[model samples]
Target: MVITVPATVPIESFQRLRIETYTDVAAAALLVYDYLLTFNVEKSLIWPSRWNIMKVLFLLTRYLPFVDVTLVLFYQLKTNISVETCRATYFPAGWFIVLGIMVAEIILTIRTWAIWGRSKRIGIILGVSALVAIIPTLYIEKVFLDSLVFSPYPSPATPGCLLTAGNPIIAASFVIVILFETLVLTLTLIKGVQHYRIASGRGFVSVLYRDGVVFYIYLFGISVVNLIVIVAAPRDLANLLAIFQRVMHSLLSARVLMNLREANQREYALAGMQSSPLQHLSFSQSRSSEEDRLSFRRNLDGTVIDIS
Candidate 1:
């Protein structure tokens, strides 16, 4: 039974789709460029570090996009892809994006958790708020994906899938993202104010605060644009910024980890150089004791700086 549906997508939608393909490629290119630029820092600073939860998160946020964007580009650019194949790809691709965003948020949440002196109460609050935001957003995405109606390609030469229409309810997901980011930014600002009131000058804590605020703002702005497009633009333009948002989340979160690690290493090196000769001699004589001492100090500093 051949079920034929009329072509409903306009020429303008195809033009927008072409632009979207370019955007995805650009996002992927940026990911590769960033990786090359930071490869040395990652090797020197991250590789030697012991295996930990944060290391796992950093690697996921860093490398998962390679696989994601590859799949996305293939789905978008592959010629003669069947409608069924295109439909099948939507669920995994959408979930992959949601997964990336969630992991990045976890990194931010942990950072927020640390800045509050690792208070269990604060941790619980953040954890619960994340869940509240995430649950509804996921539900909305699932509903939107399930409701999507794909139009058949006008010709066999068509390179990608086309959407007949988009559900405006998808905008809800970005609204939730903006709200959650607002909560995270508010928490960071409150903590920053408290930290600066006591501390006279900038230090590692300042770095965490600065990055948190800046990244949150960036993510917030992107989410706003995404929401506006989904609500105000044509159905074809609804997802124009989705790939960019995911890439930014991965890029910025990876930077947060790398910058924190590098700063910690520099602080440790400076502290070591300033030690007295007698102290150095003592440390040299008891290498094992020094290792333990340094390890404890690293953990303490990591906690203060929200490395986890």
Candidate 2:
């Protein structure tokens, strides 16, 4: 097979690539530093819990890409490497990025499941939706891999994967993720609001409302920004935005999970402390002629239903 070598990029494109490399390195360093600082607090608690496991995976997914990309950059900096080898690196790097995003999305789906009071139906629906979304994503990944070609004359500084040959499919892939996330976030909000009516004063419910909204806003805003940047910005600049998007996904997803766990722990502790000879509020669903009704059952022991 004849090798199709990519042409050297323009000076401006080379500069953009340099900036992307530097920024990615800085972001990765910051993520590592933050993870280490909190290691003592989270180390024992992370692996055993299912939620924590997903969070850990999300973090790894983010970190691994940085390592892979850094190595590719360094390899490009060296001389005498075959174009094929350098071009080959993009496949795995891209896969890492796609896998990380999928993991993050799964975490969000789980969070939505819990927010919906562990409804099996909601979980199933979201699961199916996620599977459908992955089909198109995998197609996009293939397109990206097939498009990978290194510049024929490698620049001294930037000699990695060049802009993918024109492909609208790659540009539109972000929308699939954005729509899926928006659906998850909307479901979460709906469930939260419904539960909030009855569980408004409860600590766990309040935590959900506070943290869940913030999480959705952060991810949603960035996804929109990423989509726009990919479509509108020059390819080199678009690449930077894409990397930064993954960084934010790692940071925010992990942050929200950690905060929720901490809040749950605190609520559990406070409930234990405040146990008194008060009546426990037990909720019951009643069917009436017009609609369903909610009734509370009182218990002799002073424990309220521990929502946390």
Clashes of 1: 0
For model 1, residues 179-278, the per-residue Cα lDDT tens digits are: 8899889999998887666553344556677888899999999999888887787667777888899999999998888887776676566557658565
Candidate 1 local Cα displacement, residue 65, angstroms: 1.4
Model 1: residues with Cα > 4 Å off, grouped in runs: 1-8, 276-308
lDDT of 2: 0.61
Which prediction has the highest lDDT against the true structure? 1
lDDT of 2 by residue, 1-308 (tens): 22232364567877876777776667567667767866654655454454435545545744665665455455435455556666666567677677767776776676666666556798798989998899999998787667655554454443444543545466667898888888888887786677556553444445655666677788889889878877787666666666566666766666555655566577556556557444253321223300211111111001212212
